[model samples]
Every structure is written in structure tokens, then in C-alpha cells.
Target: MVLLHQLDFSYMFVAIILKQMTPEKVITITRFSVALSFCWPLPMTSSRNQIFGYKVAQMFSIVNVNLLLLPCFYAIYLRSDDIEIVAKCISQSICQIQSIAQTVTCFCKHDTLQRIVDELWTCIREAERYEKEIFRIYIARCGRFYGAYVAVAYTMTILYLWGPLFLPIMHVVYAEYPFDVNRTSMTAVVRAHQIIVSHQCCAHLCVCVFGAFLIWFTAARFECLGVEIQRCTDIRMLAVCIEKQLRLRRYAQDVISCFRFMILFVIMTCSLVMTLCAILIITKTSLLVEFMFLLVAFFFLLYLYMYAWPADHMKDMSLSVSRSVYELKWYDETVRMQKDLLNVLVCQSPLKLSINFLVPELSLRYYCTYVSNALSMCTALRAILDKTVA
Candidate 1:
């Protein structure tokens, strides 16, 4: 029994160690994959093509203002506490309202309860108004970062679609030292280098062609609301402003939907491409399967963040905003819905504070404590499974 206990404990320790190691390995591999993805050039070679590509890239960059970069960079650079503040605000509002509701529910007399509920409703309305006003400012600030983000997205998409075609040529020209076939003779090496350089030049030409197409497509399809906002001056323009705002919102929603679909397609395509590449590499060389798996894992992680997570978040936010907008039936109704939605959008304010601070933490703590109490549940299940198997 003592020996069996020791073996069980050892196995458990190993499992814990492995689990911790897995997250660290995943982080490392993901970093490398992101670097490689960003570094790889598309096929665009000729001077004319390069100029065209630059022009195309510049079009996207024009609207991709410093505003978009700021929030995203801040999010990346900010401490965990800052992120936690945003998350806490989101979850806490619901809890605080529920708590208020519970307190209001305690009154048994109908007349008194009605009076209390009225006061509570007034308080809720006032709080929501303040929250919305504050959130608008925050979102306006966040919009600055949106432009930079779009530029990055545009560049990444261009690279992903056309990068594979240039990989073989890139491999030939920039082959790592000790792997160069013509390394023994300087003349041979120079000739091989020239050929590889010419291939890269040709690849860049293709990049320019596709890049120009994307830029023109995006510029023609998506107009910047910021540009319109700058041009508005007349009072009668308010009607025009309203129409423009609605149009912009609809365009944003459509773009988000399209992006989500594009990401899904890319992830599926990349998965297949990576699988094929791995198979070819394994067949051609004696590289370890474990290393190949790690490489694939890295690519998947990059895809998960750059494609999957962003698409999912955008879809969720778009749906939420659309629903809130749809709920507006009258001027008063619109104001109220706007207030609630704004509270949800803003990373700060009490409405958000009450939900995050009072709800998820409580639930999470309860879950953790309960799981600890039932620590042997897994073991018991394992025993049952073993018996069933026997």
C-alpha cells in the first residue's frame, strides 16, 4: 500500500510538471511562429511592381491612423491589473443590479415595495447615464488604435495569402550557413546568390500585384467616418451626419463579418498547408517529428490570436452592438439602450465595477473551493472506469 501510494504521488507530480511545461513550450513556439510569419516576404520583384505595391500599401496606411495603434499597443503593454479592471467592470454590473433587486424584493408590503422599486429604478437610470457618458470618451480614445490595427491586419493577410509561393526561392537565396551548396567555390556561390536574388525579385512582383488589388478593393469599399466627421460644419448636416454614422456602422459590421469568414478560411487552408509541409519535410529529411509538431503548434498559436480570437471578439461585439441598436424603438428607448451598451463597452465606471467585482469572483471562488473539497472525485471516477474496463 505504501509503495502504491508513492507511485501514485510520483505520477501525479509528473503530470503537474508536464502541464506547466506545456504552457511554457506553447508560449515559446508561438513567439517564433509570429516572428517567421512577419518576416517572410511575398512574391513582388520588379521596380514597377514594387512601386505599385508601395502605393497600394500606402492607401491602407492612410486611414490606419495612430489612433488604432495606441489602444492595442496600450493593451499589449499595460499591466494585468489594467486588463483585470476592464474584465471586472464587465462582470460586476450584473451582480450589483441583482443585489439591488434582491434588496428591493425584501419588502413585503406592495405600496412600500413599489416606492422602493421606483427609487431604485431612478438610481439605476442616473448611474447608467453617467456610465454611458464616460464610456463614449473611452471608446473615442480606443478608436485611435483601430487604424493601426487595420494596417497590421491588411499586411498580415497579404503576406499569408502569397507567402508560400516565395518560400522555396527565399530558402534558396537566404539558406542558412553550412547548408549552402555552392559554399566551396566563391564563383559558384555568387552565381547561386544572383539566381536566388532574381527569384526573390520576381516573387516581390507578384506581391505587388495582389497587394494593389487588396488596397484598391479596401479603399473603394470602405470609407472612413473620421474623414466625414472632419468635413461636417452646417447644422442641417446633422441629418447627413446621422445617415453617415448609420452607414459607417453597417459597413463596419459587414467588414467584421467578412473578416471572420476570411480568417476561418485561412485557418483551414493553413492547417492543410502545414500538414503537407510537415509530411514533405519528414519524408525528405531525418528531422524529429516532435520538432515538426512544435513548429506546427507555433503556427496554430499565431493563427489562434491573429485570426481566430480577433474574429470571435469582433463577431461578439458586433452582435451585441447590433442588438442594442435594434432594441431602440423610440428616442427615450434608444437613449436607455445606448446607456446600458455604453456601460458594457467602457472599461471603467461603477455599472461595470459592480458586475466584475461581485459576480465572477464569487462564482470562481465557489467553484475552486468546491473542487478542492471534492478532490477525490477524479480518482473515484478513474476507479469506476477501471472496474468497468475489467
Candidate 2:
């Protein structure tokens, strides 16, 4: 019965770890799918016809933007939830293990009990480090996402307020024709259409400008995170050199991955904005021209969502690998310390056991196991990052 209970507990632990890992993979895949779906052609037949094409295209653009972009936002929300869940699970696990170590201490020798205490303390510290890193990455990513939404909202507002003002202006601009010698006047319909199109062109320009600002802002923020991560890694390496157990390598890597993903999103967004700008500069006053620009903008917005979806996954993987690396390094240090202490104890040296207990056989073995796991996670994350770039 005791053996069965032990097995069951082990299974539960494994299950939790698996659950935490699964969400990272799922989030990455979903986000990528959302990004690719933006490139698909619109289904409206009227959008392609010269007479009614502009209105049809405009309607379809609205639909695509709402459908594609909204879901990407939803995906980010889900990923954030997953990160919080994993963090809580890790914290709880550490507490439980610590409690178990305390309970088992009464039956163990003084040296053995002390070693176990030290190891448990190390695990708690590593877990805390992991939690901190994950939280930081989450906040940064959220900031970029919020900034994007703000840009879109501002663009829509500009369009709504300015659209009506253009109707009269269009009538004035298109009313005078030099080549029509037989007729002395222009129709009210042509004038009104011209006014509306002119207003739309201005609106498109404003949206493009807003989008450019947002993308640039996001890119800059991501770059800052990259720099911070690099600093952290340097500090972590220094700690390692001093024989201190600190797990921060994975954190650094995650920062890099986040930056890469954000850059891709910004570049794509910038390209879309440039295309819209070019369309606006054309002197042609036809409705077809107006519709084409709106369609392109709508598709680009969908593409942005799709591009951003996988970002959470990449961030998660980076965090996991960093945590794993830190834990492994901590374990290795604990083992080394334990072995030195054991040596002192066996030699009947008059040295204090607490100070000498840094290295131990059990700790060394555990460190090896942890290191192996960390390496595996790192390798996996690296592969994912490569694929993302490709």
C-alpha cells in the first residue's frame, strides 16, 4: 500500500508538469495558424466587380479584421492564464516537498537531515526564480499587445469622425471637367462619390500612420527586453563562475525569442502600412481604388494577429528551459557541497559540519539528473526558436 501511494504521488507530479508543458506548445501552434489565415482571398464576388466592388470590399474587410484579430487577442488571454496556472502549480509543489522533507527528518541522521534541508531550500529558491522570470516576460508581452489595440482603436475613431466631412468636398473636386464641351455641368452623384472617396483616402492614411507608430513602439519595447535579458545572463554567468547556483540562462533565452517574434510582427505591420500609403498617393479617384486599400489594410490586420499568436508559446518555452537550467545548476552545486561535507565528516576533521556539508553523493547524483533534464528542455526550445525564424 505504501509503495502504491508513492507511485500515485509520483504520477500526480508528472501529470502536473505535463499539463504545464502542453499549453506552451498549443499556444505557439494556434498563433501561427492565425497569422497565416490573413493571406487568404476575400469571398465576396461583388468586391471584384468594378461598379460595386469598393463597397463590397470594404464590408468584407471589416469582417476579416474582426474575425481574425479578435481571436488572436483571445489566444493571448488564454496563454497568460496558462502561465499563471503553471506558476501556482510549481509553488505548491515546492511547499509540499519541503513539508515532506521536514516530516522525514526525525527518522534520519543529523547529517542526512541537514543535507535534505539544504537541497529542499535550493529547489524552493530555483522555483522562485523561475516564477519571477515568467512574470516579467508576461508583462512585457502584454504591454506590446495592449499598445497594438490602442493604435487600432485610435485609427477607427479617426475614420468614424472624419468620414462625413469628406462627402461635400468630393462633390467640389470632381464637378469641373475640361474635356466635356457639349455638357456644362457635372452630376451630384459623381460629386458625392468623389467626396466620400477623398475622405476614405485620408482615413486610410491616418490608420497607416497609427499602425506604424504602434509597430515601432512594440519593436522598441521588445528590444529593451532583449538587452535586459542579456544583462541578466551575464550576471548569472558570473554567479556560476563563483560556484553559486543561480538559474537564469533560460530567462535570457526567452527574452531573445520574444524579441524575435515581436520584430517579425512589426516588420509585417510596417510593410502593410507602406502598401496602404502607396495606394493613397495614387491620383485615381475611382471607388475600386478606395476598396482595394481597405481590403489590404484589413488583411494585414488579420496577419498581425496570426503573427502574434505564437509569441506566447515561444516565451513559455524559453521560461521553462531557463527554469530547468537553473534548477540543474543549483542541484550540481548542492551535490558538490555535500560531497565536501561528507569528506570532512568521515575524516574526523574538527571543522563545522554545516560549513563542510556543501558536497554529497546524493546531491551530486540529483544534480546530474536535473542537468540532464535542463539540457533536454533547452534543446527542445532551441529547435522551436529555429523553426519560428525559418
Candidate 3:
């Protein structure tokens, strides 16, 4: 009961702070995110993401973000045959890989990200006109939801790291380090290092989720802008609407470019993540608390799909805006007005959020396809890994 109460209090407190993330705070977080990514150097030799040879490779030293916890990982797992320890090491390695991928991706898409941020700030400035405004309310709600999700993920991760320190709080033996049992400098050093990397990873995850929220707000903002466009009476006002719409479209392009890799990741991995969690949930395990925490992690991971939703919404709304312009009384306008109206061409195709034209558009339909593919893969894996009872 005390644990639950403490969790609730922590959630509320964190959420309160998170909701206050204005555009400036978001940029600060983005910079913090970029900084964390640089902690681990990218391999310049990797042909996939690198420009040349592995020249950008980070040193295998403590200061490097990705390698910062190598000592702690080894110290904790050196002598342990525990499943939790092995799982932790594997998970952390995956995180390091993702951090590396993101760092490289960020480097490649730095300019696009800046433009997206500028466009996002422009929307936020308009949205924050007053709390009672619809856009204000929508974004605030999104911020709260984003905060709650991030809080849950961070709490689970923290508990995974520090649970062994306290008795009852750690219902199961999750991580048993092989370091000297005594409170030595090494122990303190390892613990502090774990805390730092954990927070940095959490920041990375937060940036990912916040990006989705930004997409959601962008969709809603475009919808509002579309509504304004439809309500325009004079040619001048209509022209203004057309310009804003075009700008929003350009912003959409920048966003798509900025998060192309994220889109790819969500499309490819969301189903696999859930499938793994489902398998774990079905399989017997002694670490009930740990498994429950895993569920929290899975829940957060699934939200990666949220990024696609708003984009699809924006695409639909953009299509609607284009169509709605046709419904306007353009017949009554003068020849110059008609020429201007004719000059503003509607996009025949919907706005597509995609990865450089691969994997099709980012939409629920494609998401379902990825999920179905994952389910099939999971089924095959289970068949291969688990023998028949007969």
C-alpha cells in the first residue's frame, strides 16, 4: 500500500513538472537528448549510417555515453547465472544500439529537426493564446498523457536499477550484482554511473514520446487552420489561409524528414515488442515484479505508434482542406480572384509521412500490416522454440 501511494505521489509530481514543458523546455530537452546521444560515439566505419570509414567511432571509455556502464554491467553480471542479470545486459545493449542509431540519425537530420522545431514553436505560440482555447486544451491534454506515459516508463526503469537496494520494494530478486557486498567506493561509483545513464536513456525515450505529441498537436493545428481556411470570405483572407496551409505542408515535410527513422522503427518493431511481452507473460517466471515492470516497458514501447496516428490525421485533414477549398463559392469571385484561386493548386495525393518513400505511408493500415507480420513471426518463433507437449 505504501509503495502504491508513493508511486502515485511520484507520478503526480512528475506529471505536474512535465506539463510545464513549453516550447523552450522542449528544445532544451532536445538539446539534452542530442548531448546524451553524443556520449556514445558512432562508428564511422559502419557503411549504413556513416559518411566515410568508422572515423566517428567512440572510444571504449567511461566518458562515452554508450560505454559508460560497461564496467557496471560486467561487475553486475560477471559471476551471475541469473536470468534477470542476463536480460538486463541484453536490454541495455539494445538500448546502446538504439542510442547509437539515434545519434547517427540525429546527425544526418539535424537541419530538418531545427526547421521542425521552429515550425512547432510557431504552432505552440498560436495554441497558447489562452488556456480555454481549444488548441490550448488539446495540447495540454496531450502533454499530460505524454507525461503519464513517460513517468511510468521511467519509474519501471528506476525500479529495475535500484530495486535491490531496498527490501519489500523489490518483491523479486531482479538484479544481483557480484561486486563487493560492502559499501565501497566502487559500489558507489557503479551505482552513480547506472543512475546517470538510466536518466539519459529516459531522456531519450522522453524526446521520442514528445515528438509524437508534437505530431498530434500539429495535426490538430492544421485542422484548426483548415477550419479557418474554410471560413474565409474575402480573397485576401482566403489567400492568407492558402499561405498558412502551404507553410504547414512544408512543416509536415520537415517533420517527416526529421523522424523518418523513428517511423521506420515503430513500423518494424512495435509488433515484435508486444509479441515478446506476450510470450514472457505466458511463460512461467519467478520474477513476477520484474515481469510486471516489463509490461510497463512494453506499454511505453507501443506508444511509438502514436507518432503515426497524428501524421495520418494530418494527411486526412490536409486532404479535407484541399477538398473544402473546392466547396467554397469561387464561382462568384472576380477573374483575378479566380486566377489566384486556380493558382493555389490542391494536393491530389494525401500528405505521406514516410521514410524516404520506403515502407509506404505512415498510417494505421500500414501499422496493422506490421503488427500482422510480427504476429506471424512470433508464431513461428514460438513453434520453433517451444516443443510440443505430446
For every candidate in turn, the CA RMSD to the true structure comes to: 24.2, 27.1, 6.7
**Which one wins by lDDT: 1 or 3?**
3
Q: For this target, which candidate reaches the highest TM-score against the unseen true structure? A: 3
Off by over 4 Å in 2: 1-137, 140-145, 165-302, 309-319, 322-326, 329-390
1 against 2, candidate with superior lDDT: 2
For residues 216-299, what per-residue lDDT tens digits would candidate 2 score against the true structure? 223333333333333333334433422321222222232232223233333344354434434333433345444544454454
* Model 1 residue 27 lDDT score: 24
Q: What is the lDDT of residue 278 in candidate 2?
A: 40
User: Candidate 3 — what's its lDDT?
Assistant: 0.59
| Per-residue accuracy of model 1 over 1-390 as CA lDDT, tens digit each | 533454455455444433334222322322232221111122233366764554454333322322222332343344334533332222222222222222222211223323332332332244343333333333333222322233333344344334546544232121112234454595465444434333222222222122122222222222232233334443344346446445534443333322232233333433443444444343343344334444443543343333332232333333343333334332443454446434433522110101223222112233345334333443454456567657
Residue-wise C-alpha lDDT for candidate 3, range 1-390, written one tens digit per residue: 645775797678757776555655644544454354442223223345563222254222124555444543673566355655555554564454555556566666654665566556656665544412545555565666655656665676677667777745532222334456357886666566666666656656655665675576567666677667667778889878878877777877776676778657644445545565556544544575357437544643465556766667777876767666777788987887777766665344578777665677778777677667666776776676576522
List per-prediction Cα lDDT, in the order shown.
0.33, 0.34, 0.59
- Could you tell which candidate, 1 or 2, scores higher by TM-score? 1
Off by over 4 Å in 1: 1-242, 249-265, 273-287, 322-390
Name the candidate that leads on lDDT: 3
Per-model TM against the reference: 0.28, 0.22, 0.72
- Residue 43 of candidate 3: its Cα lDDT? 29
